[model samples]
Target chain A: MGEFPTVTDVARVAGVSRQTVSNVMNTPGIVKADTRARVEAAISALGYRPHASARRLRTRRSSTIGIRLDPMIDGISGSVLDRFLHALTEQADARGLRVLLFTATSPEDEISQFRRLNDGADVDGFVLTSTTADDPRTEWLLEQGIAFVTFGRPWRSDDFTAPRHPWVDVDGYSGLHAATRAQQDAGATRIAYIGWPSPSGTGDDRRRGWHDAMLERGDVSAEDLACLEVVTADGVDQGAAAMQQLARTAGGIDAVLCASDALALGAMIANPARVPVTGYDNTPIAAAIGLSSVDQPVDEVAAAALELLAGEFEGKSGAPSDPAPPPFRMVTPRLITRQFAAIPRDSVPVNALVSEVSR
Target chain B: MGEFPTVTDVARVAGVSRQTVSNVMNTPGIVKADTRARVEAAISALGYRPHASARRLRTRRSSTIGIRLDPMIDGISGSVLDRFLHALTEQADARGLRVLLFTATSPEDEISQFRRLNDGADVDGFVLTSTTADDPRTEWLLEQGIAFVTFGRPWRSDDFTAPRHPWVDVDGYSGLHAATRAQQDAGATRIAYIGWPSPSGTGDDRRRGWHDAMLERGDVSAEDLACLEVVTADGVDQGAAAMQQLARTAGGIDAVLCASDALALGAMIANPARVPVTGYDNTPIAAAIGLSSVDQPVDEVAAAALELLAGEFEGKSGAPSDPAPPPFRMVTPRLITRQFAAIPRDSVPVNALVSEVSR
Candidate 1:
């Protein structure tokens, strides 16, 4: 036949009804083994491929996940999302699911997209990224009883034990704490912290890591700790400027810990020979320049997000209706330390040694 | 009323047949204006959503584009695809299309995925990346008469004027040519060219740019031009090694031009103060380290690929059956010039100046 084969064609070829043909394709367990075998043979012989949309409409389930593809803001840190997306796609594909991408300008637009995709039955669930404080997207999703898992914590409250929705986040506090401790172990007495301004959940969490690490040292007084901390906007230039100021006022900073690779890079640029700097996110720039940084296990985060979405929290406490704490995974990060003769300034020397430790 | 509103419910509410309701939803242009308006109102009042799969099955168009999400191999150059995917998602969204992502182990697996998506009526077309010589994917797509566009040229032939399929690619030759000219104009007479090994389409094209630029200068002999060039596998370490070998063997290298930012960065790291280098792709590393490089206009490429897939080549002299050179777009890249006191090799001091120019 010149026309494409349809369900009816498969039914006639298999000597079965149209519903039987569909049942063989969608709900094979409901059909008898002999009849299913005949239908399968007919489907293969005639190359009768069932339309995904038609099957989805009948079953009211599309093996597809929806996600909002954010614009590339900065290649440095923006690469985290890129890596996460790649990992998510691979994981979803392994589960025989497709990842559908849409673009939205804002949280409201994203929620609207969710409604469109959910209403159209185009997606079974969603994976959200870049979670912010009191994220309206999560609020809307929770209100709608939609299935979704974020790659970041809800950040609605400081208590990580409780959240309204499932989430997977990198433990920034642990990452920075380890970085600070690593520097301290390397014999750095006065280490300076450069990070984004307060009222930011991620930045503050990372800053606290450095703060607690210094406090545990017992040698640096609380006043000295306060002086060692420098707040600035996140950027290489801002990091450089912060390092410069801290060096002048903090009385010779032996090491520097940053909230982001951009800031760490700046600090390294400002004083290549004076201090060993560690940055967060372990971006490519850090590896290229031989700067130590905290590496977020995004692949683990992706896997955990998929598990949460798959409702793999059966062994955990609380029922579906109970006010139980939603399942969330906090993946520990690894600190990558590189000891080079100097930070990449106008080339002066050589010798590079790299090491990694998970916290 | 408690259950989802289907065609039967919508038809009953609107006082129309089920087919009429479908026509209103799927082919509104064919329905009477008054009847279509009435059905739409009933749909809105009842919150009746026409299932996307049902409509797709009826119309045989899903308005979806399939793209394979490559695993993130290296954050540096891999970011180009990341940026392209983001732009493509945004551009496709602006046209009321969705992007579906899948992962495959190899080209054969990718083709099977294409068949699955195409036969299942889950996608209208595809957007392929990483085009290679005699790509079997393109061959299969051509044989299947699929509507798809590649982001790179069909390298089956060097004469880009005639390709079996439509494509959008950056003019790497022009990008390197402009970069070479820029370095020469900056008063650098003895420039060294660093690139990947030959038999590679993109690498060869870029090398020709530098080669032709040197030939045009009329000062460097053919023998000297050959001596000035060094080829190696693409990487930062490889680049540094190549640069060192070139510097020692070629004698007194004033400037360096690399096929990629990774190589350029490597060269800069090896000789921070000795050579000013330019790299291709203008990765974030280039900016962080203050290295000059060429920037691909990926946004334009995304738009052009979508246009080609949408059949925007109506003005071109090619009938459906005619072999009148399937339309293609070769976008010219821009050169970003960044001058700093030194590379980040245990930095001593810096005075940075950044500028950009289109070629």
Candidate 2:
């Protein structure tokens, strides 16, 4: 019930005028350095709070970026998304920016929300993830001339009108190839692929890698591997059902490669303790379960996406004649081998000493 | 690429005056119902976008609520947080409000960020989670006369100075009681409790429930139980080590109770075929693993919190007083059981089949 200390309190504490205290907060560089320091110290002491809503009203800009998430994938737990968002959040904070969140059930709904934001002038920019190759929303964003960066590349290159659209993509094909080759190295003649293949650019790339790797092996025929084509947005259920079906029907498959850690976790749980499951996206769940998987550099992807969007926001589109295409920034995933079969037996400690790296 | 549509286009299409079109978009009640319908039809046809920001600037209200999260917990995957946030976001959208996110690394940093927002004139109100006992920031908010609703009750009653200060919390202690009692029903007397004890009121509450349930059980004594307190913020490794220690030292513990699904997953993976583990929160991982746990009603909590906050913001104090002394709202939780235990022959089929009501 105590009255809050005002600007006058800080002014009296610092032995400066109220105008000087205001300058320290609003235009610190304009004030003498020593005086500004004293003013700041006094302000800290009094716990003075400035009215931000009124200031934003005066400035006519909210230094906040609105992020819209597709709801279908919202069911996919945060274990996969935490690292990427955390990196983005930390970096955004460092740049004196904040994030606004919008959620939509479908592509059309997301576009409507985006359009509303554009009309509202509520945010300065946007960051999008899990984009499809032929996504209609991307075209709409381009039409509105909104600055955006996506985590995954769109499947259709022809839909892009903004020659300098920025995106951060994982080398999905390369990661799958490495996983398949690793299985082959471990004396496996045929490997089963459990994944959801769609017009999704990443999924297609992974399928291509599996196909190419099998072809390179020569001994394994296309018919030998099981490809689960039905991909549900509710990936956990889909993965569980897919694994259960595979377990009931498949024969002699030594290793399984999954497109996501969620699917891999489901596959592992449903494996009846017989088969080895490998997954992409080294999420915390995979680490906890001791499933060997490819670690997509989520931190790197988030950083690159921000840098690209920041560049566009800063008006450095890279060219006037023909803007240089934003590089298809592909982060190579590292193979993170844990308690599964990758490590040598000698390295397996007899004691149950838990590793400190928790996700 | 095309010029944006204007009021003239809408008027021309609708066969109405330009003013009528404006009224249809902004103030529909002024226009005749038929005329309003015509104008709306025309606007949709032309893909007309209204200038939302200009109107907000004119009105001096953005209709946005600021949300601040603890950075350590913020890193706890968007997927886990999404359920609660999605609920809040949807509730806000239903009332035509937006959420602006402000991330802060610590409590001290959050105070400064809050000050910045207040001075910057950005947000109308705040929705804060992680309000610990003796929260200094909550006290500061009251001192500044800002509108805020904490997700939980602050520890110190004196901190609840603002007449309009409101809070919404999950019934953690009661849910924990249910979970413990359920384990006891399943013939688990020597139950091991695993989790951290800290600012997370939920963790502490669950511990209290476990303590009370054990004390109430005449068959179980204090010496028969085990408590694995994970001091590290890094949960998975801490959980694994803690579980390993409990598994080694706790001679007669029949079951394990976890503060989070993350810990349960770790324990399950580490022991595989040994102990029966139950988790709180019933996160997606818990579902995938079929761990019997308590399910927090995040949606209900979010809706209740928003309703209470909105009531306070509308100049209504003593609004949430429920004719009870505690002045607290509690959301009911459900017990989710899966394949964590060996069901009796008669119980196996019913439990194995997903409940018809659930379906």
Best by DockQ: 1
The ten-residue window of minimal lDDT in model 1 chain A covers A350-359
Q: How many residue pairs clash in each candidate?
A: 9, 20
Please give, for residues A1-359, the per-residue lDDT of candidate 2 as tens digits. Answer: 11235677879999999998887765554788689778866755554545443233334345677787444343334444545666777778888888877877788988888878856657767888778756788877765566788887765543244333677778888888988888788787657777664755777788778778888988665665444233444365566667667656665567778888777766654565446677777665555446677877877887888787877676522232234565557688787654442221122221111111110
Q: List the TM-score for candidate 1's chain B.
A: 0.81
Alpha-carbon interface RMSD for all candidates, in angstroms: 14.6, 16.8
Model 1, A1-359: lDDT tens digits are 11346788889989999999977655565788789889877876665556654455444457888999987777777777787888899998998889999999999999999988876777878999988888999887776556789988888764476777888899999999888888788798788899888888889889999999999997699988888989998777787789878867987778889999988877776775557788888788777777778888888998898889877223211132446667889999988766533454433211111111111
List fnat, each candidate. 0.37, 0.22
TM-score of each model, in listed order: 0.83, 0.74
Candidate 2: where is the Cα deviation over 4 Å?
A1-61, A72-79, A157-164, A222-237, A240-251, A316-323, A341-359, B1-51, B72-80, B157-164, B197-200, B222-234, B244-251, B269-275, B316-327, B341-359
* Candidate 1 residue pairs in backbone clash: A53-B53, A343-B346, A344-B344, A344-B345, A344-B346, A345-B344, A345-B345, A345-B346, A345-B347
DockQ of each candidate relative to the true complex: 0.20, 0.13
